[model samples]
Target: MDWSTTIATQVAQIPRSGIRAFFDLVTGRSDIISLGVGEPDFVTPWNIREAAIYSLERGHTTYTSNYGLESLRRKIVTYVENFFGVSYNPLNEVLVTVGVSEAIDLALRALLNPGDEVLYHEPCYVSYAPSVSMAYGVAVPIATKKSDLFALDPAALEAAITPRTKVLMLNFPTNPTGAVAPVETLEAIARLCIKHDLVVLSDEIYSELRYDDVRHTSIASLPGMRERTLLLHGFSKAFAMTGFRLGYACGPEPLVSAMMKVHQYSMLCAPITSQEAAIEALENGTPAMLEMRESYRMRRNYLVKRLNDMGLDCHLPGGAFYVFPDVSRFSLSSKEFAERLLMEAKVAAVPGDAFGASGEGFLRCCYATAFELIREACDAMERFVDKLQKEAR
Candidate 1:
């Protein structure tokens, strides 16, 4: 009768996502101004939604190929090459999965043996280490510091490499910190990966949301990287299609084929309607994406400035929708700071430790909320911070 005995060991050992766990306290609370979840505030563009509706009207409701609809695959590859400057054959080198989450699982499961190690930067998305663990791989973290703008350190990555290391997982324009990898740093990491012969899982879902004219250079696009890198992207972020849950993986034929094998037996295929909608998103969703990007840029500017003015020590993140501000000065743990902020200010921002231990002294404030709401949250936060400082005094 003990559920603990029946649960898989790996699943039992893996803790629930810290981000979701913290947000659970805010559930059903309509009064909170939330900067917790990373989803875009904008609705999916009407044309893209219309595409899904049109596809449904045409009765395109059946299961697609295990590799996904050929049209969608072609569109995915074209988008990747055009935007990321990394080309792949659409026929055998692209696999449309349920989302970037599924693609991460597929790649890790396909490549990892028991105890194989995955080297990833910390203060990253909550899913990276858990996905590696679920695949029976050892999750090795390379700590990225605020001084480095949270970019993955190539030297740190080199030190983490061992005989057991098999994959390097990267999420640039990263989660929590909004750190974008520099091209030179990426080139150095790419060199190390080449020397070590490690497969790179480049998760560039936030690649399109970059700010301040910060260019996103994919590790996959660097010399000697395309053959060994799996590029993961989707419509969830830029196109505001989170509910559709559509994403794809692009890489060498053999790697994509291997991921497809696992995906076929598991997910089978991404939803047909989502795939059709994704096709539209890739083909004609640019102007809307740009507008949303600009809005986020404005929000990011306002939020970061407010945090710094309130003495939170936040660096201007170059990409993504989140700002990680150092809260060590408040003399409270990240969790305590965030919990008090929610309860007292009715403002919800994620504790940075929700991402990883390296995030212990910080809080992640998402800028994807409406600008007006973000302004209100800032006002509340300023008052909350002033109260905390007075208590210390």
Candidate 2:
């Protein structure tokens, strides 16, 4: 049986996620100290977990509305407005999905026609380009530079826009690089989006994980952008609810309705237990979330300092839990560095290129693991890096 001919061309061409592919090497290893996967080290707060349990006790295990539980949707709106300063009509504008991944797919399918271009920064989350391609849209990547703290340049964004461009996707406190756009830069990009009449997909999954008091500003909150942006967020990162797999999208009624149409037939709705838990998370999960955020901040500081002290040349990331350290001096490709580190040092970190081509000479180390494990990973990396530098000399 020739499976290649049977599968859709788009599905056949897309590569498996670079992050997952790298982890496959570590699957049987118990000795590895991993700073690879981006997920909270903390368990979900007990109170939030209890909510799910309580809901199940009450026999609330049935399906929710395709738009999700009305109570949860309202809570989502309130949380967004309070935290991100973005307003939405929960009744019509919010559609809950399985995860932010689903929201990304739904928004792209809702807004894109075949051949439409979606602009996003490079060295971004591995899924962005794949999602666009899966939705039959062209993924246009604008390279962001390490010299500029990896902030997205408005000029580059403007240059990437063409008549076929339909959407601008953004993830700040971004994956791999942990780049957060300054308010001024966001304003500039918002202006360009307005000028080009493009819709924006703002993924704020890591909004609560920022460090050093950095505030996350949603592009949807800017003037003229509220109507043109789809805000994607979920409980996975901040609330440590990755296994729950709940996310929601809030946007204009027409767009949300369109996404809901596809979602209704496909995903149906996020799990009822997860929706019940999410409501509790939005209402009273802040204290526990903040406690977890503080732990991540301490780990970030220690890991970043260790990387730089080992001569890896990492900049302090303003948000997110990952650091992209320069490994070019080792004279190895990102994959080679990552592989050698995993095999020789028993420390697992992702090759930067797993994110995008712009990440070629760097390595992404996530600090979302236990502090002791992080310390161990850093120690191993320092030894590994020292050997590479000595070998180069």
Candidate 3:
């Protein structure tokens, strides 16, 4: 039963995702209404799918260049500059990745040395902490507060820094909590990073999915930030293209160069079909994306109103499809509450604690499903909360 000692200790140290526990319990149960995944419920747009089919029909089955196809990389540049107000040289600065997941892994793998430190906020996406650890980096989490609209405090961020700090990760339009950072907060954080000479890894995959007229401002777009920021985005949530497995990173030539080495060995290229699909997602998918985003906004409005009506303290998310309701009034552990509701009411939500300790008193519900489904989930929660209240009395 002995294994290699390198994997023995390291693998044991990797934290099990709190979100995965629900699937472990409910797998093969046909009745679970899962709001746990942070993806749009819509299928990939037909036009994008057709592009993938076209690529396959053209016999593009083999691996592309280690940095990915040149045409796709150029499309990525035009898309970023046009949509995100951030520009990078397509030839030197962009590397297509297999989902933002692989872009993140590639960056961490290439940059971190053993015992280096990286910082990010919590109630974060499930990947950042363990992924950094996997790269032999130590993670330092700064607690973001709901009171501040889940804003990352610049003071806390500065305090978390050390001589060992190698990079900082930022994820806004965030997961579990649908919190987006305003430009001012990003500017302040950028100031500290510049002063301390830190690299920033900014994950902005949900930028296009915001509610209101709230435009997403990339830290990468701010003064002097383009050089230090490793910007990660993809076509998943924006274009309803999660299955396409295409993402890209934009950064300084040197960082992109270093990451391409890890990417070459690990992923080679994002599938050629997906790259073609992604290019279409960039070019022709804008109208579909706008429609999808507005649908998510309607669902958000509905769920937030219903949760508030039931006396749950839920807010309309600024971006992304999730609603993180403060469930402390029920006086239940987030895990216990989520499981009991899934078993009793057949509505599956992620426990906020799935993200981190600050997430302990909340439940994350993705409102990306059909309005009927969101209605059903809200109805189920109301009945369940009433029963809990009766029992408490």
Candidate 4:
């Protein structure tokens, strides 16, 4: 019997993740050096890992409050305030989530009515558009160009707004493109959100990975935005706690309460052990994070120089470990370029189109791996480009 009709239409309609296909292609291949996945190569810092182990040793395995451990929540409050200058009430304004992924879905679920429109930048995280669709909302894409360093344009945002637009989903130090929105740009977008009376779901998982003396600016910290923004952050990128599956959302009491209703039923709470680890991450993980950020900065500098030297037209990423380089000179679609590079050079990078249609002529190379491996991948890529140029002749 065909199961397609029996499943929820939206679930059935959801497209498979574009990144998965590259993983499938290279799976179990020892020769391939992958720059595909966005995950950090570092293990969770020893202190944070030790804290979780100690928590288990103390027999603290039971679930904490549905809102997550009060202690953890309080630490989150302090972390955001001290780091971003944003204040949140731990008791009612913070809800722990399985990850920023879940926080995105929860915010959408809580705020969107059927047919409500959610506007987000394109060439964005692969999950953004699908998450909106999963919530039964209309997904609107705002195209950001490389000319602008992929920053969200206020005029483009204003043009996308309609009476039905309910939310503005933002990711910075953005994935794939690695662009950080400047304070002035974010301020303009915040004003547009305020003018349109839209909710802002700011995904800041990569906030700590910025480089070049640039600090991350959270839109939620702007005047009048605190009440309208649901800020999402996680331990995955900065703390190398991807396996821990922990994140949190902070916002006004009512919005946090609404997201909590969905979270309490769906996730119950983030894992107790992970919550314990996260407390340690917030309290004692800054030095480790700074070290990791510095490593990424070096890798970024090396990779961008190599790509530009090869005539790939890569911009210096302001934040995050990934670089989106324009590969149109190779006269190949993004997918074809990625496939050929994987097959020929055994260096794996994500096809930029995996991110969105606007990503068609580019490719995303993640520099979160070891410095040596990144250098090797660059060498391999240079050889690949040279071969293509020779072939053109």
Candidate 5:
């Protein structure tokens, strides 16, 4: 039996996630100080965990509506309206998902026809391109630069637009780079979406992790964007609920309904227990979220300063837990640099090009690890870099 023809071409073409191999390499190594994965080091807040337990205790274990629990959906409405100034009707405009991952997949599947184009900035989360491909849509990369703090260039976006362009996927408080799109940039992109008649899929999962008094502005909140934007968010980053696998998509009725159709058959509904827990996260988890955000801010400050002081060019990340530092001076590809750092220093960081080609000369260090571990990783990295410089000499 020839299995080559058995596998789908798209599945075969998709490269394995670069983040996963490093994670596997360090899985049981106690000596490795990892700043690789974006997972939050914090435990889920007691209140949120308790809510899930309470739901189980009350025997609320049956399948929820395919759209998720109505109560949870209503809370999601209130939560988004309060935090993002966006109004969503719980009944027809919100769909609970397993994670923002699933929400994104559902949106692409629901929206894109064959050969349609999906535009997203490069050095983005690893999933965007593959997800677009799986949906049979073209993944268009818009390169953003470090000099501009990785903010999306509206001119670049405008030039990328074509008749076949169907969606604009955005992740801010972006992964890998930790760039946040400013209100003006988002507004400009929003206007272009209007001009092109493109649907927007704004993944704001890290919106709660902004630093130095920088507030996250959701593109969906901009005027006229609400109807055209599918906003994806989850509890993983902000509420330390990564294990719970709860997330949602909210947008206009038609888009939400379309996504829900795909979600219903594919996912049915998000876990009932996780949905109940998410309600608690939105309702009573604000203080805990803020506290965690502050911790990340402090770590971000320390890591950026230490990396720059060591002669690595690192910019202050405006949001998200990752910092992308340029490593071109080392005269190695990002993958080679990461491998050498892991082998020589036992300090694990992700190779930036894992996110996209535009990420070739950088590395992503996640600060979501413990502060002491982060400091240790920084120290190890500095020594490793010093050794490399000496060798070059």
Candidate 6:
């Protein structure tokens, strides 16, 4: 008769995101310049928006097939093949999900047996560990140090694996930490997984956001890894289409088929309008994407420089739109530091501990904010750090 027990104990065990709690606090507080959210500040490209508009005008309002429209899946196949070198069978190897988040859930739910061990690198996207837990999987987080440039440690990763280990979850150009796995690193992981019979779930939503001369490598593209890797990517981060609720997965056919059984029960399919828009996005968004990525690189460079110059030890953001900086010198807990940054500093950033325990004593500042806002926020942080130092003295 108790409402609390009726709620799953697993759900209670999972902590609400530390990032979101403060995000709610800062909402509608115009006095603060927010760098708390990882979402891009860019609008979805006009052509992609128009594609959705056209789809709706043409009466594509109902849901598509449970596996999704074949046409869109084919486009995704071509996109992945051309860009990431991951070949997928459009007919049976791709499943459309609401977003990369949902695609991640599908992979875990479909593949994970109870108590299966799932490994992911940290500081990672906030959702990965909890998502595994929901599927009755054990989340084994392997922390990557700032010294390693937040790269996944193959030795540590291999050492963490046990007989119970079933899934290796990967997020590249990662949320909050912006670490990209180079090709050579991914091949080593591929060899490790091949030796271990581990299933790979790669969250590659930020694949298009690489900066400088760095190329984003997909673990799935490596020779042996493709068969075992369930690739999760979407239009959200790359095309600034987070609100569209569109994503896709490509993997071995049997797994994709297994996912649709769950998918059919879970979401059926994404909106037809959104699918049509995403098709166009996958097909045509590249040119604009390069421009947008260049803009993000510029922002990343500026934000990293500003933070370090202000005495916060920010690492270079290789990709994505986040900069995780050490705030340990302030002697404030990450959440308290974030709160102080928002209050006295009149600026906002997410506490690094929000992502994982490995993230303490740091904060994840999203460089997705506008250049103008970034410049002003940097100026504000300078004064804020100056005051904090003076107080300590």
Model 6 segments beyond 4 Å from truth? none
Cα shift from native, residue 333, model 5 (Å):
0.5
Model 4 ranges with Cα > 4 A deviation:
none
Q: What RMSD does each model have against the real structure?
A: 0.7, 0.8, 1.3, 0.8, 0.8, 1.0
lDDT of 6 by residue, 347-393 (tens): 98888898999999889988888999999999999998998999999
Candidate 4 deviation (Cα RMSD): 0.8
Q: Which ten residues in a row have the lowest lDDT in candidate 1?
A: 72-81
Q: Candidate 1: TM-score? A: 0.99
By TM-score, how accurate is candidate 4?
0.99
Tens digits of per-residue lDDT for model 5, 308-346 = 999999999899999999999988999999999999999
The residue pairs in collision within model 1 are none
Model 3, 1-393: lDDT tens digits are 455564656558887888786668877887777777777889998999999899899998988888888998999999889877898899989999999999999999989999999999999998899898889999898998878778799999999999999899998899878899988889999999999999999999998988899878999999989999999999888888887878899999999999999888777778888888888888889899999988998989999999889888987779988999999887799988998999889998988898989898899998888889888888998999889989899
lDDT of 1 by residue, 91-149 (tens): 99999989899999999999999999999999989999999999999999899999999
C-alpha lDDT of candidate 5 relative to the true structure:
0.93
**What is the TM-score of candidate 3?**
0.98
Go through the candidates in order and give the clash count of each: 0, 0, 0, 0, 0, 0
TM-score of each candidate structure, all chains considered together: 0.99, 0.99, 0.98, 0.99, 0.99, 0.98
